[model samples]
Target chain A: MINEERTKMMTRLALYETKEGKKELKITRYSPGDYVMLQMLWSFVCGTLAFVIICVLAALYNIETLMTELFSMDILLFARNILVIYIIFIACYLMFCYSYYSYRYGKYKKRVNAYILRLKELYKHYVQNGNNQNM
Target chain B: MATLLMMKEKMKEIYAEYYKVIVPTVKAVVAFLMLLAINDKIGYMARLDSFLVVLVLTAVCAFTPTGITVLVGLAVILGHLSALSFEIALVALAVFMVMGLLYLRFCNKDLILLVLVPLSFYFGVPYVMPLVAGILCGPVAALTLGCGIVIHYFIDYISVNALTIQGMAAEGTVDKIRVGVDGLIRNEAMFLTLISFVAATLVVHILRRQSMDHAWSIAIFSGAMCNVILNFMGLLVFDNGPSVFGLLIGTIIAIPLAMLVGLLFMGLDYSRTEKVQFEDEDYYYYVKAVPKMNIQAPSKTVKRINTQRYHTNQK
Candidate 1:
């Protein structure tokens, strides 16, 4: 699945190499959005995990006085409480992930655009110089 | 925002310029503080506790590596204990031996925290230390923290039970062992802090291994919470009249401190794990490449203002 995705990404990206003393370029474009998505996914996972640990630890503390009756505690009620906390935490984390991703993606896109522009300038120069083989 | 960022970059540039001098100076200061603390808290040898001696040794340490400072501090502490009481010194030795077997082999720089951990504890914000260790170090830090706990507890135990222990020393050997064991096991506050920190370090260390963005932030937040909560529970369970407000405020302070530590150690970097297949003359090789995190500190170019040109009025 990942290999397929990589191939798909490769198809969309501009790949350039000098092979046998000839500059080869296939028609493609550079996109920073793909890697930005990967970064976003990573951020979301970490954000969720952080909130989860915090909530769990807090709940563990709040219930310590009742540890003697831990096993006898209401099972479904406990699950419901945990589930509610998890849902709330996850919702907040998602909001954080969205803002974080937007900020980071903007910077990533700017960097990638600059890189693409540099490559484009070189390509234009090569084309303007009569394919650079006329020499 | 942009101006703030530029100012931050300027400050970072200035710090980078003197990092060589700054880092060593900080290490030496830490060493000196540790030595001074040991002298004040655990010193039994009168001569070593002198201000002149501390000043000279600390000045010497300013040019030396931090590891030597940790050794010097621990040596003075243990040496003092030995002079005061043979049994406590032997116990301290046993703790160090355990630390050697468990932590020293894997960690060259871990011992420096021996003083730092207790310093944090003294400051009432020790939860930050485990988060710092987890984000910057590895599991071996747990042993260092453990040794620190033993050191703090050893001092407290000696101070509180000094007169009683003197009486016990004239009694049978069984009574001495009993007293030692009781102090180790029954001291709820110290053990609680130990369990909390060790657990926090382990948790943060494990979470840090995940290939996720914001891992350090997550680890710090989570580990700080874990430390705070565990200590709270310990207080409620063991100590009479647990102060919930104090615990909450400490946790609040610790979380931000841990985050600052995280910021100092970790920055956001995008890393990709890629697999490539290539053939050599003899065989085909499949390689998994995970690039290291790239750190780009804010760099600024310096421009000369030419103060000599301003003095051209004289010319």
Candidate 2:
């Protein structure tokens, strides 16, 4: 008395819901632009923090030398060089995040669309079987 | 060969049927081993070094994602280092944060390599990681392998210099941090290992991606050879590099282990390859299909008749 096709379809849906579907479904909640932008923003913040940590470590490593050269060192030039490096680093990080998240969003959207179609098919199966009449 | 293949088929069947339980159990075992190894290397923190603490953490790691294991391992490393020297712990934390926030965010799965490469070294089979990484992962794994090598060297440095580092507790915090950072960066042997590992991984990944018969085998062999040659060269160039005997023995052990891992992941039947030409609307397509070497375990069903019924029928 079981509908084999329905059973198979339901199983597939359940498996998807457990696996990658968990992440992909959440992606579907956001517009593609928003999702990519959010990712870029997050990467930018993390990248900046990482840069600052590296800078602090470098400073700590050369503290003795820096202390000796503190008065003699060209503060403006040092600031400019660090700024330039920071700009280049964040630029590369943001660009990568942008491209990666954009592609990922597109792929997830395509998958979620397929999943929706399968859900519709399952609903149709239920309707055709005269079950879940309210649906 | 036949028996091996049959055993592999049986293993595949068992794995397929019980993978849900198997994966977590393997995670738990690996976590436990890793925690024990860490404690053995540097058991500065008595509380974290306890067997009960490790078992509880291992149990949690079994149910959590693999990345959680890497984080737990990192936390344990920091705990031990902090107990030994607070400044060194800060230095280690900074390095980890840079790696995590900058690189690992995009490919966090590679975090496991941070745990694995060190464990492999502890087990005296260091070459397995790069060889397996090359076969199983993309080219980007070279970077991850390099990072893992750096981490291994850092941990090794910490354990070896724990007493000296503790002696520097009266020194300025910046000086201690500088010493810790210098110890990591100035290691010529670490640099050599990093170069060798990265080179081997790249070679394996590149060769494996080629469209050729016995590609995995060729890749594994070539990768192993590449690792040995690079390490040999490193030994000659660097005054203090990895032990030559360890290099040879590790490669000897790694070749077969990596090959076995490759076989499990990709068992292709190159002899049964099929090359066909077809035309699409836009262009002609020449495709080569390679079959996988998959053998399902034989299922035997024994049917028994009722003894009394059989006897009556015979009568």
Candidate 3:
């Protein structure tokens, strides 16, 4: 059964190789908010991972190459540099996330509110019969 | 102010009129420059490295189908590699085959650009491709962009380090292949560009969809800024990169190119936002309208100027 399911998945993947198929295969059950949320969530994870990995690599470079020649005196400085970079990365990433989320939410909220008002107006008109039809 | 606005509208009309021809021609130039850059950097055959040949082929490509251009360009590169050596040719062929497989799987209109973009970057003409991709393509195109960067950097890394490559070749086939694979993995620039393009694509994609004034311009500017800043940060962290002034100059050039991409894809006028409310038997509907901004194609209707002829015949 597992093998059969895997085969089905593989077949679907192959089928969606074409442009039309890919477009047809979109998971449109979610709202734009959910879509954006998923996008940001993945981006955040990827960006954070990238920063951590690069900083680790930088630290490794410092230890393996610069430490033997420059000695223990600069160790504190190297560590400080890594900390500063990581802080900068965090600050920038946070700012971007905050701005992007707020912008999306602001517009989404406006549309949703407008929809609610329209629905309320319709309900009011129905309660008043044809006298308030224009409402 | 009214006159200036009128002039701007007129200019937009003229721009839209020739956009079809212009797009293909620009793509052709980009393709030609990319092919030439690859040939100059990595080609083995001196005879096939002629400027006229690439120019003619690219010109023909502009008129022909996009697939034809891609095929011809690949064939030329393969031919050059074969001239260099059978082993290297085989290596390049394998690379091409894999990319071709991926292309088949994606089956996208970005087939030509999926390869050409990274090659263009390798030549220091990176401004156009990313901006164009960001302006026009979806988030999924980032995957193709990543693939392009890997192939470009891999091939470039091998071509530049002849001594290491030749030494590895002397050892054995397995060693040679290992060296190529290792170089690809170790390439930091490739990773940086991949990240930059992906981020830019996402930012532009989202921003362009917003129903707001100046969204396109904002998207273009921000996307360009993101690409420049990301690449700069990557270089600073990983390797010795271009100096600050050089970077600044490149960014300056890039913004306008990005703006051009924005203009080509998004019309000059803002798409007016509309809100409407309606009620059905079951429920009320609130709809937001966004209009597509495009120019109507020029159409012709012929009417004979026969009034004078009819008058003369009547007389």
TM-score of each: 0.55, 0.81, 0.53
Total residue pair clashes for candidate 1: 0
**Which prediction has more favorable TM-score, 1 or 3?**
1
Clashing pairs in 3: none
Model-by-model DockQ, in order: 0.02, 0.29, 0.04
Candidate 2, residue B132: lDDT: 92
lDDT of 1 by residue, B1-315 (tens): 355444544445545556567767887788777777777776777888888888888877778776777777777777877766666565556556545543454466677778798777666676678888887776878878877886777676766776676676453444544455456567777788788889989889889888999787787778877887888788878873226787678777877777665554454222234455543233344555444423344578899988898789668
| Order of models, best lDDT first | 2, 1, 3
Comparison by DockQ, 1 against 2, better one: 2
lDDT of 2 by residue, B1-315 (tens): 566677776666666556678889999999998999999998899999999999999999999998999889989999998998889899989988888887777666566777788899999889999989988876767777877787788888888988777777575788789778977789999998988889999999999889999887899899889889988888888897988888888899999999888876653222333345543233344545343447755679999879999899999
Which numbered prediction scores highest in DockQ against the true structure? 2
Stretches off by above 4 angstroms in model 3 are A1-135, B1-28, B51-56, B163-171, B240-245, B267-315
Candidate 2, overall lDDT?
A: 0.83
DockQ-derived CAPRI band for the predicted complex in model 2: acceptable
Cα lDDT of model 1 by residue, A1-135, tens digit: 123333322222322122211211221122345544664566556555555544443443344445766788897897898788777766675665555556645655555555466656655644564332422
Q: Report the Cα lDDT for residue B190, model 2.
A: 94
iRMSD for each candidate structure, in the order shown: 15.2, 13.1, 16.8
